[model samples]
Target: MVADKSPKAGVQSVERTFELLEIIASVGGSAALGVLAEHSDLPLPTIHRLLRTLSAMGYVRQLPNKHYALGPKLIRLGESAARLIGSWSQQHLRELVERTGESANMAVMDSDMAVYVAQVPSPHSMRMFTEVGRRVHLHSTGVGKALLMQLPNDAISALVSRTGLPAATENTLTTPDALLRDIDLSRGRGYAVDEGEQEIGVRCFAVPVPDAPTLTAISISGPAARVTLKSATKVAPLLKRIAREVASEFDEHAAG
Candidate 1:
């Protein structure tokens, strides 16, 4: 028989293409050819070939400054993907809202910030409300911190340096050291909290969606008067459990 050419041969190339795309995204959506080579640990020639193909496919663009950036075509795909995630998240948010008597929200990382994609408002008139599509800093909000929890310390530091950790309230962590400490505590507790950081009188509890298709988080927010420290202890476990369920359902749907 002649030399065989299996689809497996193509799979490796496809995987490499996606890997390069991820590397570009990881480095803030733009990378010089040398930077790409260094980060990917792939040969310059391989990077060039893959980037060329991606450029032709309109998934990557070569900048005037000789860096490669995520192309405009990706925005459409990303928006569509976010919409799907938001749709799937609605029922989970509803459950959290019903059980916790607070507004339940789902957010995903976007443009280096966490943006709300779905929300189920509380029945009570006094509940907190963060509109869907509102972008909040990763250092100043419960859902934002939860979204960042899984990233490496180096990545988190880099993100903070880029975003500058602007304070939204007196309680917001404005230093990397403080934010890291808070992240450590959040990790230990298996949840994150926003105590008047995003909004005065509002307290939020959030958990990262484990094994999610994207960096995603879900949260419940209410008046700080109603959502006390004692109640946070009770709400955190439920937030974590529901987050896992949301991730499971999302991953199942993605695989199918």
Candidate 2:
């Protein structure tokens, strides 16, 4: 690929190659070469060449059906990112599950949604289930509100205006006024709560993700019956403590 620096700078090959990886990542880890080429607007030969290099580098994998997917190398890289927050979340999450006897998760805001970055399950066969990498609306999740608390009130209001609190369940807070009130409460108290707003019969309590620099949000969720006020009262303090620890560890790592 020759540089077109004589006049208008053309697209860089390395940049386009990473963009193709992003396209694959956007499509939930996998996509066909044709789709990637079309989506990236790169020539088919160029895409094939890039895929070959990426595959060799262990950043991408080629399927038997000729599709390409993000490879384990990305997982290793993400695990490194997670370690940047201290690998203790796994230990803390398990302890939380044992204490509450319900499923728990830690997630971070990915754009306008929250993505489950880590999870630990209760010993029960029937418990709340949230897969890693799952995306949920920021307006309807504890992690969402926790992350929102990081931004200023005016900024949050603007985001709500843009995203619009589309109703997930009838119980969901769709009005801007209601959500703003809830955000204020979450900020004042240091944790966010979901009462069957996202899913009926599912209650969640989320503490503000500490450390604005890492942009991490942490949360715990389970059945409403088990995660009710009485149970939450028991768990809230612990959740806040762990969230602070995670944030503090990340901050220390960054400082070091």
Regions of model 1 farther than 4 Å from truth: 1-10
Clashes of 1: 0
After the best TM-score superposition of candidate 2, give how far the Cα of residue 48 lies from its true spot, in angstroms. 31
Backbone Cα, N, C clashes tallied per candidate: 0, 0
Give lDDT tens digits, candidate 2, residues 1-256: 9756774465688888889988886554689977897788888998988889999999999889888988878867765675444355788788788788887788775545677778887788767788877888887988788877787778777777667888888889998889889999988887889888888888888887565454567777877877887776778898988787777666666667
Every model's Cα RMSD, please? 2.5, 9.3
lDDT by residue for model 1 over 47-91, one digit each (tens)?
999999889989999999999999988989988888889998888
Question: Candidate 2: minimum summed lDDT over ten consecutive residues — where?
Answer: 79-88
Give residue 193's lDDT in candidate 2 (0 to 100).
91
| Alpha carbon lDDT at 133, candidate 1 | 76
TM-score of 2: 0.66
Worst 10 residues of 1 by lDDT: 1-10
| TM agreement with the true structure for every prediction | 0.92, 0.66
